[model samples]
Target: MAATAVLQPYNEAQYDHRAFDSLMDVDESAYYFDSLTGYEHLRSGLRDIFMRHGVSDELAVALLHRHFEMSTNEKLVELGPVSSPWPIAAHEDSVLGGHILPHTWRVFENELHPLEFRFIPQQEFQDARKVQFSQAFFEDFRQYVKANGLENVVGITQLDHGRDADESDVQLMEVTHGRNSIMVPAVPSSDVSGPAFQTIWSFVEKQSSKLDADGIQTRHGLCYKASSTDAANDGIQTRHGLCYKATSTDASNDGIQTRHGLCYKASSTDAANDGIQTRHGLCYKADSTDATTDGIQTRHGLCYKANSNDGIQTNHGLCYKATSTNTTNDGIQTRHGLCYKANSNPTTA
Candidate 1:
């Protein structure tokens, strides 16, 4: 049968979040599926997945064979240890057409919510290739944590597009928790997708910390693109799953398009926020880089941070900044707020 996510079955054994995060990057050489022209590469990837799980060589081979059979077969049996007590051995489960396969594993609290993803900034996902994010990406992740249905999903760890060892060249990222987790495939070792990541959590605690409900700080920062002059995709576009910028000449080769800022992208269904700026610990939004005026900005949606000094620009203190309002000082002013008087208009004497 089909499972929500793509994964083999796992035993009743408990899984650790850190261990799962480590699995997100496919081994490239261990995978064996070749729907695409890159079947051998996928096979190599599958081999590494086996090693990551500490599966023996023979078992790995069996899994490969089963994967092949499953790839071709649709009416595979619905019974067998693949359900619960998944046997590490393929030969043990006879009901699985001699090829017992674990249910595909999908992250329940991942991707993005329909409502949330829409709010994503336009520039966030545009050029998925060259995205270097900032602290705001972490903040968005934190909001996702609060909005996530699964309480077990504490926070997102690292988002990368290449090798697991090189977090510097990271682009998109899946989340991590104490118990639940997800996996992603690797792109290339030499190429860093968007050599920049932003971490949005108080601290990286073990499962114990998440269970305790104690929170941590999120340190989010995007990578610095080497001096480059670009004009193709100087704007921003948030796509289905990635945040990219068509960086004109960044050596990192990440999809960087914006001129003066970094890029942060979320799943397709997550809220998108673009043109975010933090000045004096306050987040100010810009219409776009091309926009002449940068002063007109807005504030926190749904929730506001203690350090967030955001508000709409107004001529009076009733809004964000203190504005001067000239009143006759003789009308029925029901609105209670700071007021100013006309320059030459004298009152009753």
Candidate 2:
């Protein structure tokens, strides 16, 4: 039977989406206040409104003039604690790391005070309307998918509205989620043409369901002549599979028989027959007192086997050098290089 597939379609024009301008129209107009109570009420209302539209609490307070200003021109001649040494205004650095000299020095009670430095524009929001809307829409869609248990989704089809329904763009995507997903294509079929257009819904659907292709179970067994030493033989390395080894003369005379020649059996049996022994990681110099000291003498001089508890080990059974002696901790060292031994359970961390 053909495998079943799920299709999810979203039409942007059908939804009653709000305009970007409508969401960002913050009221910065001044309000009239006859009493202290009226002023407080107005301030509170403005703060709530600003916050509802994504404004931060600090920015809302600043906008309402509830926060104190440290760079005000009126503070130039104000009296401050004279105990601190007065540094020249030109020596002072602005927030931008630039040296800014004041316009003039105020003579307050015959004491000179720096006054009126250049004001630099602070950073503001840089996201464009289209980008912000795309991000918001994606986040909302992710939440919707999670809440509705659509985590097993295979693909997505989106229709973006243009000036008219006929000019709309259709986006098609085949997604495989592992660590994180990425955008493939957003350009509509109506806007562009060529090989790049094949990534659309129709093409992906056709490719995913193409027939006459062999499945894993129905695949044929691979055939090739054995190497002289039979060192790097390539065969079907799947579970429950077996390989037949034979000399070239015997193979030719036997007319390429199946399950005929000497059997190497499975991986473990074959590895043993090949005389491959546990390298135990390469021989490293280890002290006699070290726990990992193998005490075996070989052609590579005095070498020690890596500890089994070390986090990273080569197929031969040696621990990685960097894994043992990083900047943070000192691992066990002997004739065998540095060996890392976890004081605590590594799995818990």
* Winner by TM-score: 1
* Candidate 2 deviant stretches above 4 angstroms: 1-136, 145-324, 327-349
State the C-alpha lDDT per candidate: 0.23, 0.21
The top-ranked prediction according to lDDT is 1
Worst lDDT run of 10 residues, candidate 2, spans 216-225
TM-scores, each model vs. reference: 0.18, 0.14
* Model 1, position 276: C-alpha lDDT score: 57
Off by over 4 Å in 1: 1-197, 203-216, 219-257, 261-349
lDDT of 2 at 58: 15
TM-score of 1: 0.18
Per-residue lDDT tens digits of candidate 1, residues 51-134?
A: 333322112111111111111112222231111122232223223223332222212233221100011123433432222223
lDDT of 1 at 59: 21
> 243 in model 2: Cα distance from truth in Å?
26
Report the CA-based lDDT of candidate 1 relative to the real structure.
0.23
